[model samples]
Target: MPSFVSRIVPVYLRIARANRPFISTEGARRHIRERTLRPQPYGPPRRLRADVAVTVDHDRGWPIYTLTPRTGQPHGNVVYAHGGGWVNEIQPQHWALAAEIAVRAGTTVTVPIYPLIPFGSADVVIPAFADLVLANRIQYGEVCLAGDSAGGQIALSTAVVLRDEHQVTLPRTILISPALDLSLSNPEIPVVLPTDPWLGHDGGLVLGEHWRGPLPISDPRVSPLFAEMANLGPLTLFCGTRDILWPDARLLVDKARGAGVEVDFHEATDLVHVYPLTPTSEGRAAQAEMIAQLKTALETVRR
Candidate 1:
């Protein structure tokens, strides 16, 4: 059960129709059109926390942001990918979380503002991300990949690509409400979507078409949910029962466990999608757990 603070989110989203862009084909098209016509600024927030230092660089044209704690040397590396259905820019909330991870966990957090759909898709971004993760690993000795929604899909796919192509696997991965299958073909989704305040299959399919590019909807490149899960490192996954993507998370947990992957799964009985990223009390608790997980994982890397 969700607390009053967290449970109120659904009411707000439902009243505001925040799911409009993700629930209808026309709504998605109009939203994307408006964004293309009038682009919003992307990257680190203008007024970032003073305790963290930010450096920006480019990797094959993708903007990579490295955030370090101003206090002292960081312990490990975290590459955070922000989710936007593959077209949305990084949100202020993402920057806040990255900074928190950098400071509280005492690790360098790298946020890659990968190209959106119609500009670049999984094919170009995943390999590039693998290279970035590799670069960070060489410098820091270990790297953790993390993301939410489409970004979570990319982060997981990058790990898979690293394993298949480079014969290397990341040490850890954190996926928050990951959009597992772009195909949106899960029969379970229809049942869950009705109660989901902020997502719909029709709009998701449209965004999926743009995000998959040259690959099929089920391709592992764009949808890692279909990929093999063997030989990967431990995973920290969070999901809520109210989201359409919740069903896929359950399937992933089963597949990953079957493949002998170590999974630390967190499920919210009444919360909505990405509830961990919100400003509610449950979100703060989830963030604290994330920091703890990063600290424990990074401490091992240091040793």
Candidate 2:
């Protein structure tokens, strides 16, 4: 039942093995130590190669890059958090995706180079993100939050924090293969662990523990699934059945529906984690749905 692009299956499997060691407790410790030692530079902005309006400013306590198309006025704005499992640096895929979203959806997309774990935890990262989102919301008027994997967690959590503590509201949230439950202690996870070619069950839990810092792993701040699902924003969630986090995605869907929130849930059988970010047919379809969601949020704000 797990259907993925045949050609990429082997590549994904190799990635899984390469990442498997970090699934252990010791692996997490060692990775944090190593990552801290070799702090990665942001390199050149990917948008520089394209014909888009790009600017970087540290007005929000840290550098935030904004990308806009040169053709037309943007419909709305999006603040995307890049995923790195809370420890890794932002990949080129993230930069390319941000640019694509800007061009396809006809919206300016702002990506913040947020700090990762050990260097940044719930206490430090979330507040800075909240400020960034709030500032964007005020500027853009109707901002939609979006991210993949760990970035997805931050996107969701930042929205919740602004709503609860800062009294700011967002239009919607888009999460692709989000690690909603940091504990990764779900009962049904073992069922998919073997079939999941890109994620390890134990490694995810170890990373989650380290990422949560002083907060309990199950705390709503770290695990948005455990948080009240009522009013974060309109939700559009995408996950693959083969992803280890699919079960948690399902649970979050149930909770959101129970809270009378509108949700557009898209689950593809046998797709890999963050399939929407991939350059396959299924991935394109998923990206189209996300663009539609962003457009819809723009309409809602316009009304």
Candidate 3:
């Protein structure tokens, strides 16, 4: 049986769907304009445990946040990209997760604040972020690429660009509830749409168009679901059956495996989108597993 929290997810998802218009382009534009005048959304940053030091810097003019634990001996590095459906900016929850990963993994984490849609598009953002990750690779040797939702798309796209265009190879890539196919036209999507109350197919499709800029929706940089999967890296993905993106996640996994790429996928039955970020038992467990995977990946890089 699903947990009690799991049972009520659809109710909240429905409520969120009803309130979705508030996050549309018009809404997001207004929110972005007024966001500066308003107080910080994540509240004042509290102190992080484990003596981890957090600093903000810039890479090629983009904001880059660096988290390093006091150990001063990181096993490996992780380059993280945050997800907000290609339009929404990073939230307080994302900051909290960065801190947690820094403390637990005791590794250096570099989070590049890539531009959101309306402000920038895949053509502009992907290369800039690929530069940041490439810098990490040069400085830290092999590094892991990680992200959630749209961030997941960016992370995977960056790796692809590095591999194909720059002849760079990543050790691994991890995606959580990634919007692999921005078109959201998968036949299975409509079958699962009613169950996904948090994400509207119509709104997401619009945002995807805005992100695509002059490129076609099927461009590998915009929709990695269509990208060549071989030689990318070992892939790890997490998604819930309740998420509208679930079908695409499964599709990508199947395609990657068929191409002879090693993939570790965890699909939680009936769970909502980005369950690992939630405050539920399953979410916490998933997070723990991710951390463990990070440690193992980093350790392998050392050997």
Candidate 4:
């Protein structure tokens, strides 16, 4: 059940309606970067118990934050990527979530500050992630990749690449409100257009332009929807009915199913994009639900 505040918070809904007609892939990218990229306030400072280090890869520096259990419990490992339309660094919110997952799952979490958009591609960041996995091979079992929004796209791409090109077996992937289609042309758009809260036609267009430079919108790397999912591993997707990416989520599920991939789709009613970021009661409840789903998904992979 949604709390009173969740029911009354109309900002996300209003933003969606106001920006609906003009939503384009490029516009969405730009709007997200502009609105969410502002420097986050320095959160309560506390050093993590896990080891932190930086590695230089192909002339670019990648920061890795590793969190391990204090009692030496062995568990699965996850590589988490932060979402900023691929244009922003890992923020405090990401760090907090990473910490929670690491502690609760009794696993080490490796967060790679992947290069953002307008400066990098999935081709660039995916291999860098694979390297991190290889370097830390002994630390984790049943490797899983997870992320939200654009980070979800990166995680999916990395899993695909690792399985196909690297022959590295990643058992599972968890995507929260993934932005899989850069083309923004899902057939369900008309039906989902009115309910989405944070994303709309206008914002999407702004974002798409910034992320895709000279490349066509249908490029497989830019739009995972067009990519071949034949060999992709088991997948779990969490989405909000009111999210602008709702249509994209549905399209992905259908395509994945058609491709013979095992997909678990969880859709929440009347929720907005990135609702887990909020501190409201509804947000906490949703977060708990997602975490439980993630645990079950991981367990299935282990089996």
Please give each candidate's TM-score: 0.97, 0.92, 0.91, 0.78
By lDDT: ranked, best first: 1, 2, 3, 4
Model 1 lDDT tens row, 1-303: 688888789999999998888988998888788777776678688798999999998745877889999997898799999987887889999999999999999999999888886676887888889999888888887888889988889989998998999998777899999988998888999999889998889999988888888888888888898999998788999999999999999999999999999999999898898888988989999889988998888888778
- Worst 10-residue lDDT window for candidate 2 reads 1-10
Order of candidate numbers by TM-score, starting with the best = 1, 2, 3, 4
lDDT of 4 at 29: 56
The count of residue-pair clashes in candidate 4 stands at: 28
Give per-residue lDDT, candidate 2, residue 202: 66
lDDT (Cα, tens digit) per residue for candidate 2, span 1-303: 433563476376676575653456777777778888997776436445475778888776667889898887787789998887898887777887788788878888998888777767876787788877777767876788899999889888888898899876678889999889888889999898877777776667777877898998877779989888777678899998878889999999999899987889999887878888877887878888898879778867877
Q: Which lDDT tens digits does candidate 3 get at residues 89-181? A: 777667677777776876788877776666779999988878787787778767888899889999898888988999887777888899898
Pairwise lDDT winner, candidates 1 and 2 = 1
Q: State residue 94's C-alpha deviation in candidate 4, in Å.
A: 1.8
Top TM-score hit: 1
Model 4 C-alpha RMSD to native: 4.5
Off by over 4 Å in 4: 9-60, 212-216, 280-282, 289-303
Q: Which stretches of candidate 1 lie over 4 Å from their true place?
A: none
Q: Each model's RMSD to truth, in Å?
A: 1.1, 2.1, 2.6, 4.5
Assess the local accuracy of residue 97 in candidate 3 as a C-alpha lDDT between 0 and 100.
73
CA lDDT, every model vs. true structure: 0.89, 0.81, 0.79, 0.67
In model 3, which regions exceed 4 Å deviation?
16-44, 47-50
Q: Which stretches of candidate 2 lie over 4 Å from their true place?
A: 1-7, 44-49
